[model samples]
Target: MRRRDLLASAALPLPAWASAAPERVLRVGTDIAEVGFDPPRVSDRTSVTINAHIFESPLTYDYLARPALLRPQTAAALPEASENFTRWVFTLQPGIFFADDPAFGGKPRELVAADYVYSIKRFFDPRIPTEHLFHFENAGILGLSELRQRALKAKTGLDYDAPVAGLRALDRYRFEIRLARPAPRFVQLFAVPGLTGALAREVVEHYDDELPAHPVGTGPFMLQRWRRGSQVRLVRNPRFREQHFDSLATDLNAEDQALLKRLQGRRLPLVDAVEVNVILEEQPRWLAFHGGEIDVLELPPTLAPAVMPGGRLAPYLAQRGVQARAQVDASVRHTFFNCEDPDIGGLQPERVALRRAIALAYDNTEELRSVFKGQGVPAQSMLVPAVYGFDATLRSAAGSGDMARARALLDTYGYRDVDRDGWREHPDGRSLTLRLAGLSDSRQRAINELWLKKMRLLGLRIVFEPGQFGELIKNSLAGTLQMWSYSWTTSQPDGDFFLALGYGPNAGQANDARLVLPAFDRAYEKQRALPDGPERLAAMRAANRLMLAYQPYLPHFHALRVDLSQPGVEGYRRHPFTRDWWRYTAKE
Candidate 1:
């Protein structure tokens, strides 16, 4: 039903349950500040978390599914895929309206297939700086890349009115996308709300460069207030179409089954509002949780020993009705060396040996024990355990720390203390020093100390260059930083996103290491066209081996995420694939 039809009645009566109950609010916290609300413009997890609530995608993950099943969101059903996996069709649900906005002149605007088409086009516009352009380029979306190239060469804006063979709206409620090559895992893009959400053309044109501040969508929630990097507030969208809580809930454990029972038919956005505070410090976030200012807390690794002694919730917290849940997050942390940096960059044997020695010398075990408090497992490759094409039996010397081997490799590469300065010199007798870019947080300082110790033990000079997290990201993308440490969390169940980190075309975007090996890129593309079987898996492994052989990035470990919730918070569960959980949770 249309929103006006439902809200037209002036004397409508409220339900007994809603009329008698107090306003429900869910308070949450994040360790990082949000960069912006615009989905395509931002890549940070904090911004994505906020954008997920204010945007509507074609599909979303089932809330109660363990294996991350996909379900239709704005669409009436799952997309229809062609036999060759090149074409996809989606039919939008009728009568769904965007949140009330000035762009619509105070009238409710219905969502249509064109909104999604325009949103996709936004990523290809040369004027917009988007990090996601690589994915669509890699997907070989029919004429989109050629159009983008034309715009770039012409030094003009993308001709939105121009027709493209690959992307088109079939009708008012239906759209089609045709890829040039097979992409079996391409459907996963529909499930990512933050990356592929529909955007109204009217709203985009009305706001222009200010669109990030004015996000209007057909989701269950609408942005009420935003304080840049400080805080974000969202309220239930009164014009949202009727949607009840329902899921397949397949293979759920006993605890999840009970949760499904409780939330089976509840209206979405069970809480009236959601308030997220940007708390960058660990101690303050913990204090806010303990003081009841925040209803949910993602416990930091440094505090794990105190809150979860011996991997169990403490008695004092349990007695107070606090609950703890821990899961191995589908993420991989690594220190990447800039393959384009003049100092440590190149395919020369000496340069490759230097990187391999450094990777061999760094100890993942020590980092997991000291910094993570035994909250992670050593990572064998860029592929995390939660995705396909991950081989647990795969082994590599790059991930295992061996001081003796590292020294021998350095010696073989002509690196030695030529002047007896207790530091290694380059093959040409030039002073060698490694500069690592890091954040200014206390946690980062601890990690940097470990890096310093490891490098010093090998008689290699290392220095720390600390800056804000966002600043480091910019510098890394510009290929100005020699090395930087960070983590990437997968948003899809496919391993392609992780492997894209080494693809040459993704240099300034996903490939922060700027690795430009043609062989690895060939293997990555070859696997994308193959079916998901032993052949595809072998291709993925070959690509991974090429990356490991070069040693552009030293794999660290996969972190374990620990979450604590107050007794009043109900229906809260950490999803393995999605980050937006506020709509499913409520506070007493």
Candidate 2:
């Protein structure tokens, strides 16, 4: 059967129970295809959004909390930490069972502490080579790094039976983690979906390397069907444990209170199913939502003016009973220079001067107004609002750009039009050309044109090399791209991950810029050990200043997140850090 026909057939209503409430289903339209379902192997936002519903992390952030408060999800309670903060212990909630799978030999498999230990150890296995290994590597776990090296050297592959001292299971329900040093923010790691979600050994062994296709978890939903790159459907898990909505202690507005009252004490997973369609273009996704084919719409910034003029929903949309909510997202979009490339890399004075001059010449404010249609704010520093250590007083030196100063800096560094071709050449009389790796989308094309126009004013010539997102990521990780544009969204309300992106050890992993700075390394290490206070904030500020001085990334703007939903959709709230928010949502 055709792909669309298959999906349409799957949506046919199921027989309803006489006493049970009617089933509610949510249909979401997205412009990007999910890379995979395996949390450790996939790092893209689309994949994370899809997998989060199927996996249960040890800890999760409150859905409606404004400042992002962490709460226990699968655990009975928050883990207990030692006085020095090096050792922590957690006990799992009893009676939790994994979804039914043939790998279990027809018996329901109960989730245990050993499952979490095995899941974390997978990050260190050289065969899997999970991209998120850096998060664990930086935590100073005693034997993890050594075990990874040992497995790489062994003739045979990793032995899942081997026990590591740093990660141990005390019993079926309890486990402890020992860090080499004090890490005050260690608990935050548990909130990441890739880090704490439990995976059964039997399931992993059955699926082997193709585990992304088979996902077994103890969350509210289970993967029912997936037509790779076309569509995916998730049905409510039959073995999911009972859970109810609880009120928060934090202050909430009137609207939020009303939402809470309606949902309090109600069984979770208000929706019975979720259906996602992959439409890799903004116009089609937007149209799908407008035609009532999808329930929720995440409007792109480029289309903000046409759909929401003056930052408000258009009258036509309002008349259709569509509600709009917009807020500045906790993310920073910028262009990263490959510090390993000889032309744009290094810490010499001339190299720094060139980077700073380029920063000064490019205009972010104009792009925010023209390309983004006033839907974004100029980024002052790497740290966005709401994250700890973000100082409101800190500002970027060339955020708005000083054209005159940029010209002077370039001329002083001997970058001039020597051959009179109206473009600058290398200071040493060598040819100089910068190639930017980009995606061939309308929004990216418009942004690239603006960048080209601004760089031309500095007598510099730049060319765009367009490719797929996956190809760009591969090239960036290999350090083959001279420059590229990317963005990072915070998964927690802390600045450690953002600062760790430039650390030396993360070169081929999270540090796509390949920046190696000893100063940044020391500050980051010190900051991670200290609790949230003035001292840690000071260390984070110092690191931010050093990154600005090095100029590895030309600061860009932080865009706004605009969401639209039909009036019938209730209990909908946007989370700053978490995705897969369908559990608390329902439609009339």
Stretches of model 1 off by over 4 angstroms after superposition? 1-21
* TM-score to true structure, per model: 0.95, 0.95
Q: Kindly give the number of clashing pairs for every candidate.
A: 0, 0
Candidate 2 clashing pairs?
none
Point to the candidate with the largest lDDT: 1
lDDT of 1 by residue, 36-64 (tens): 67788887778887788889889889988
- TM-score of model 1 relative to the true fold? 0.95
In candidate 2 the C-alpha lDDT for residue 210 amounts to 60
